[model samples]
Target: MENLERTLSTWIVRYRWWFLILMPLLILVLAKGLDLRFNGDYRVFFKKDNPQLQAFNRLEDTYTQTKNVIFLLVPEEGHVFRRETLVTVERLTELAWQIPYSLRVDSLSNFQHTEAEGDNIIIRNLVQDAPGLSDAQIARIRDIALAEPLLVGKSIPKDGAATIVNVTVQLPGIDETGEVTEVATAARALADEIRAHSHLSVHLSGMVMMNASFSEAALGDMDFLIRVSAGAMLVVLVFFLGSFGAFGTLLVIAMSALAGMGVGGYLGLPFTPPSASAPLIIMTMAIADSVHILATFYQELDSGAGAKCRREAMQESLRINLQPLFLTTLTTIIGFLSLNFSDVPPFGDLGNFVSVGVAISFLLSITFLPALMILLPARLPRFQFEIHMMTHLGNWVVRHRRRLLWSTASLMVLLTAFVPRNELNDVYVHYLDESFAFRQDTDLLDKYLGGLYYIDYSLDSGKTDGIHDPVFLHKIEVFANWLRQQPEVNHVNIITDTFKRLNRIMHENDPNQYRLPERRDLAAQYLLLYEMSLPYGLDLNNLINVNKSATRVTVGIQVLSTREVLALEERIHQWLSDHEPALVTEGSSPAIMFSHIGEQNIRSMLGAMTLALVLISLLLIGALQSLRIGLASMLPNLIPAGMAFGIWGILVGEVGLALSVVTSMTLGIVVDDTVHFLSKYLRARREQGMPSESAVRHAFSHVGMALVITSVVLISGFAILSLSAFYPNSGMGLMTAMILTLALLADFLFLPPLLMKIDKH
Candidate 1:
């Protein structure tokens, strides 16, 4: 290993010009493939074979692959049934059909009102001739809208102050990258036009807008968060590494980030919110390698006897740091690659991209950084205070080893005990902070009409035209009623509602006849009459399949935590099992999909992290060449994440998909400090034959400051990331920063004392 590193360093110095020129050109060539496009589709989070996603796909395929663009119309007078409001709403509903890919539009004006005159059924738009409607007609419209189950909670609020115009769009699926944005753009333009000409306040909210916000939030973070991270990194680097040397470190990290993101682009990975954070994470992680190499090089130059020239000093730095750097880089890569085990694909992309960045950083740190150091007149400021602080800290730990060992151990145990305080919870709407207009509009929609959180169930009766069977219709009605009874349910869109309405209309609009038909023939006839009277695209195709063997029931719930969402789903499933087993199926929707994945990811990431921990421990056992020290190293390496979780449990008490992979990420990162510290300590003990106490002091004096520098940089980088408007990115940043900070604490206070005690045996 030593000979290889020597030869590599010698080659780098001998062919410095070649390395300096070729590395950038290679990175540039890779950068040419950086054609990154942001995809905010909720589907991006799930794998193709994911059960919930598959169910959703099957459900959509069975009927319409509909994406919704809902415009919330809140009149200034807070009365939606007024003549002018009805007139404006009628015009807006007509205009909404013009939205690109719109397959259907439903609003107060377009709601199909059915009536009976002399045994003939009549179906037409509810709000016709809106400009000529008198006060009596407007009041009758309000009375009819409020009385209708289908319109009450789904479109118009029970209070009748606001209503929604929902446009059902079917994207061609050939160009999903921009189709959602196109729909949202057209919707927003329509909204602006309505606001300009009418007294109504229009706010956009629906699945399409939410998807569009994903791209908006991701693109916003890439520009804003990356710049914030870069500025923070610049200040930290210049302060710690001196101006000229810091520039080299910055350059190395920048090139590494480009390499990582370019590799992702070359691999055809779209930038989702999670993956969009790669550049900032890459910059943060890449710094550790450059800092380690440069710290040693500067130390050698300061020694005044270790090297005769800058080139020799760099080579010596490379020789000393090469093994530890390689070990850390490999372990980190292994840790990140475990993200492939995640249920969520975007997290896997994040992990893979960061792994690439870490590898590239290691390569450039040893080659590009050193070559540039040799060419540039780089002079780093000597930190006499840092050395003195490390020296004193080492002495302090030696003096109070027993106290620190017990105290830190007890604290770690106490914090680890609090780990269960964290409950798995993810709310997709809350993923974006209030800064996003989508979130604000969604909140308003939830406050007014109904919830955006919905669950879709495709209930199959298992035979042709089985939907008309009295028994099947009864079960559907029972389930819909059961859903309506749930506290979380804001609305239930069921075919039973239409059947009851049609039954009453067929019976000369008798109020007492507003119930399900008792006979199969009657139900079939009612459905046939209703479908025949409906206009094209407004037919029952969305609710009932062509064969009438199955129907879809969509239930909207108030905004709730993912834990609550999953609990409601469990309750629903249990109800179906107890009462209607044959009609039972997994609920399919973006909300349900996200709800299931957060729990699944946490479980999978833990398994992956456990495997990574085993592999990393074995590597440590080999690298340190001391089974005892390697075994001891696990104490510090593992405790930091547990302690961080404990702190999070106390502070936040909620773990989401973003927090699920923190253990794996921080495990790899925190190991770098332990490896460097333990390696230095073992060198003093085995090679110099120093006592354990002396070895502890030696480790602290040699590598303690480097650990601090890297920790501060990493922590600062992620802390800046916590400022992101996107919750997943911000939560990850905050949690990672917390873990890295704790890792440093464990390495400094706990590792030394534990080492001294363990080695004594």
Candidate 2:
């Protein structure tokens, strides 16, 4: 193995100039990233065949599409009844209908209010006259709005301080982001105009804003996060590799990121927000290969080998580090490949992108890096202090083997116990933090208007026109009333509410008659009257289908985590089973889909991570050619992630969809340091027949500084993830960085002591 590596390095040195120029030109050819696309829609997280997505689509097909652009208007007086507020709302309401791809617009000024007028049914806008409305008229409008089922808590809050202009848009098949941007751009301009002209604070939010947030955060990461990560990495490299080595390392990482992203573009996979972390992740991994090679080369040169020893140093460095690098890269690729097992496509994309980056990094590390080192002489002296400190660390591990082994093992076990504390809870709206306008605006809406979270329930009556049956309406009314009573549920919109209103209107506007009609015929006639009075696009089609067999109900709730949502869903099922057995159909929506996936992803990742564990273990065992040493290596490789989750359970206390995949993601990466450390120790023991203490010393003497430097570089790279605006990327990054740091500790403080105790060197 050493002879082959020596030959390759010597050959690379012979043609160093040609290879260096050629490799970079090849990298440059692959560095064009403008062709890469990005998708920000929340739906991109789910696959086409995902049951929750299909159910949501079916629900959309039955009712109007729920994707909307909402403009929340907050009046200073804490009441939406004022004439000036109504005027602003009226103006916005009129403009909302004209938004590109808008299918319907609902607001307080355009609510199809119903009342009785001496044997005549009156249906008209609640606040059409705006400033011209008399005080008595405005008072009546407020009263009716507060009492209205569809308007209250949807357009006008039941508490009456804020109102929303809800515009439902049906976008074209292609360029969905373009359509969302158009609506958002127009809405923002319009809101700014309204705010400046009327002195009212208008906040824009909704499905569109959330979708746009994904794209905005991803683009921001690509534009800024990658650069920040590179700058941080250059600092780390300089601290470890010094100026000349750091420059070459940074250039290789830049090429790797560009080439990896370019490969993604070639594969036709767009970078969603979650996947946008790939460039930063790739940059970090790219440094690992370069650091080990260059650091070792510098050591060989500084050990009195001198300028003439460049080829020999490169040869020895490559010969020693090749197996570990290859193994680490392979495991990382496998770990990332496990992302394909995820329910979310973005994670899959992320896994593929980073996997490719890791692969390219390995190739460059072996070829381009060594060639660059030979071509560009790093005239700086070797960093002898790091080597001396690592020798002391090795000696200390042997001296305190018993205490180090027992203490670290016990502490890790204690940390692992906290892993169960984190629950699977995802809130899609909070996926982007306050660093984004969407989050700030969403928080404002949730605080003031009590909007956002929703669940769509499709209730089937089992027979044609059965929706008009008094029994069905009564059951729906009971269910809606039950939901409204729950603290989490703010509003429930049922066709039955409209039916009850129309029935009351038909019966001389008597409050006593504001209940489900006694007969099916009466309920059917009231619906007929209401449907006849509705205008185009504001018709009952959104609520009831043409067959009148099934009705769509929308339940509005506060922003709750998936754990809370799952609990609520279970309660719903229990209530439906006890009260109305046939109404036990499943609910669907973007919120529901994400809520369900947070649980499902954990289950799916369990299998994939286990598979990865087995496969990687086999690879390690085979690579080292020893059952005992390879099996022993598992403790160091696996303990860090387990310990990290336990600590995360303490620090963060809760995780979302990211928890399921973090194990595998960090497994491949964290194992690299262990492989580098262990492979060197095993090589020393098996080949040289060194005593346990000498073998441990030899291992540290070979790769200790590389292990620490690369881990620091990797840690810095992933630590950048903690700064992400997107929650999943942030969580994954923080978790990975924590595990990588812990892996360094485990490898440094724990593994060596265990080796000494086991081998009795």
Score candidate 2 by TM-score against the native: 0.97
Scanning candidate 2 in windows of ten residues, the lowest lDDT window is 29-38
Identify the candidate with maximal lDDT: 1
Candidate 2 lDDT by residue in tens digits, 260-336: 88888888887788888888888888988898888778888787557646777787788777878889899999999
How many pairs of residues collide in model 2? 0
What ranges in model 1 sit over 4 Å off? 305-307
- Give the Cα error of residue 584 in candidate 2, in Å: 1.6
CA displacement after TM-score superposition, residue 338 of candidate 1 (Å): 0.8
Candidate lDDT values, in order: 0.89, 0.85
Q: How many clashes (backbone atoms < 3 Å, residues ≥3 apart in a chain or on different chains) does model 1 have?
A: 0
